[model samples]
Target chain A: MTYCVGLLLDAGMVLLSDTRTNAGLDNIATYRKMFTFEDAGERVITVLTAGSLSVTQTTIARLREAIEDDDATGETSIMLAPTMLKVAEIIGNTLASVREDIDHKMNATKVSVSASMIVAGQRAGGAMRMFLVYPEGNFIEATEDTPFLQIGEHKYGKPILDRVVKPSTSIEDAQKAVLLSMDSTLRSNLSVGMPLDLAVIERDACRVSSRRRIEAKDPDFARMSEAWSNALREGFSQIEL
Target chain B: MTYCVGLLLDAGMVLLSDTRTNAGLDNIATYRKMFTFEDAGERVITVLTAGSLSVTQTTIARLREAIEDDDATGETSIMLAPTMLKVAEIIGNTLASVREDIDHKMNATKVSVSASMIVAGQRAGGAMRMFLVYPEGNFIEATEDTPFLQIGEHKYGKPILDRVVKPSTSIEDAQKAVLLSMDSTLRSNLSVGMPLDLAVIERDACRVSSRRRIEAKDPDFARMSEAWSNALREGFSQIEL
Candidate 1:
């Protein structure tokens, strides 16, 4: 299981992803799921993948290959897509093809290998857009009303986002919200673990401005974790029937 | 769908369940999930059921019939059961049987129907105990190290439980913890809705001492809901990245 979140705000976008993946309880390993495509000032897009690692890794490799291919066309690339919507379409198409191919090979064992991706970024002068690409290859964009998207082990972390996020939210505050949200998810579930990758893209900058890896014992996280626990206990104690 | 939670604390046991049930997004209705059986002062057992309402409702009805029988015996009754553990065993066995019965009826359509329950209360001098009965009729007790059990649409509400609940938590605090927990779930999942039911059993009392039904527009819930939103915003602002 994994937990990846992307928030598109007025100030910019924030992306966070955990590093834990498992084939089974005993076969746990850490695999970074956040992938970035940066042409610095030209474009900076971050993709967070979850579900079958094989499908995501293959799709990403194919994407990178497409970007490098001089002959790559709209059918084979997200980089050359005209709009964020087209970029999303290219990603959805790739994810779908990768999943079906993997499913065919794994069908002998009757196993499903569905994967989803959270794609967010800006293209120099373009607006920052965020999308959740579904396992079926369909996709939904973060509108002004929604403003954020989450994938993988999402339920445990959704309440905070539902309550706090908006398109007008500042990038600085968006970072805190995603971290604390991740904090909540990490505490309740063992499958989503630490050494989290966090990236911040200032709107229209076309580049990720800040990137941090929060290790298991990062002090800021420790403070936030303890503070959240205290707030809950105190908040709970103060509520009267 | 529903969200039900049970906590076994030194102060006693707390059981909470939402009343909303839905066959699908368009088919929503209310049906109480918390059922209490008390031969007051002798024993008190509160069962919170989730999943396959048909199976759960039938199982509870059968258990009630056995307890209501005039000449009930250990083989056909819960009232005559020697201990709370035995009561759990009987409930689990009955649940499994009811599920299998329903499964057979649905077999032609290839639909799968299953049920699970959280049973908690005290029996005279026996210690307060709680068990999470699985769909397979197997069960596990809540211990000091892990003193709470949740069933159905649970993840959306579990973070607060992880941060605040403990073995020594008072029944009153546990009650608030669960209500707040369910409130979170209600905000995040459309599948989970309200008119929440909560029951608290004081240690060794052998009956529910306090219970509440919080409706959608209840003033207290609304206040807490707003306060939580404000507090979360405040908390987020106070934290530095």
Candidate 2:
């Protein structure tokens, strides 16, 4: 019951994630699901997670612990990884191991624990990249032909992304697209609630260029959502049957 | 592997269903999922189905057989049912029993068989009604607060319906809304395919007033789809980020 999206545009990468997590209909809570690791201009990586909160939180916590370890190396710490690809691999493996550990513990009770993540960032002198890391510790990179990745409660918000996003899209437009996409999802699903975490990485900067947390009643976000809804209504009325 | 939607509006009722059935990605075929039964000028009923092909097809066949039975009564035949509510009850019971029958036969292998349906129609002196029949013989009617019901690959197309559909919407506009909704589903899902069956029943008509099968290459449908896509794109670009 989460919705997170990442867009890899020629100009940069745009990412958004919702904060709601629920054990059941009655046990709902808000939890941060976006994590960032930035060595300023040297390297920057953001991870947006969805699925079992326990698995995602543990995976992210372990990744952070690795970064702070005195003996941390490129192979063990995402922040010190040699490239964006290796960073994704390190995170994916951590996530998979954490999920398996939880799954094994819960096996006796027939409970399941799984998670997925969208990793987007870059290192100095390297191409900006974005990947969707699966629960099995495998990942797929976004390319020019398909420059976006979404995980969890994605269908309600996907048609707009399919129509509006492309590799050559500007950073500003990319941000708009992801927010509007999230708007559609929010309206359609009760499980995916606000506030939301948003991050933007400018190409070659090797650091997050902008970050914002959109609260449930942010005036600017409300205005944009209202405007977009009005536009869609107007557009719908004009289409011939 | 299907998409069927039914809308109940003040002007009338509209229903649309895709004709795709698949055992897997490799085994796909065309199968009609919309069924109409009318004692013309007396009562008109349309059923749109999704899920297990065996269960749905068998249920529909049994309903048809009951209609033609010499001993058929209000308790056994939907055509002779006293009210639209009774008709829905009959259909729901038949569907549930058939599902259980099939489920029992498939029990050894643990393969599941289940299906759901949307039933919409009006009787001579009764009001038009639409009900979403669940697999367990229970059903819920569409009300002014929620004037539409969709089954199978429903999420991708739901946001537009949430925004556009209302009890007072005109039949023409309702048709347009459902088609646009289906267009979105078609773009997002490969399982929901072409050659759609569309049926409209005007209030008090007691029979289908208009019906059309939109083929894969239907030019008018193509034009409408193209116009909608363009309108959405234009709307997306005009919105203030």
Q: Candidate 2: where are CA atoms >4 Å away?
A: none
- What are the per-residue Cα lDDT tens digits for candidate 2 across B146-168? 99999999999999999989998
lDDT of 1 at A141: 90
**Candidate 1 wrongly placed segments (more than 4 Å):** none
By summed lDDT, the worst window of 10 consecutive residues in model 1 chain B runs over B232-241
Model 1 C-alpha lDDT per residue in residues B36-101, reported as the tens digit of each score: 988899989899999988999999999999888998887678777888898899999999999999
TM-score of model 2 (CA atoms): 0.98
DockQ of each: 0.67, 0.83
Summarize candidate 1's per-residue lDDT along A1-40 as a digit string, tens digits.
Answer: 9999999888889999999999999999999999999889
Model 1, residue B207: distance off in Å is: 1.3
**Fnat for the candidates in order:** 0.62, 0.77
Query: Pick by TM-score: which candidate is best?
Result: 2
To one decimal, what is the Cα RMSD in angstroms of model 1 from the true structure? 1.4
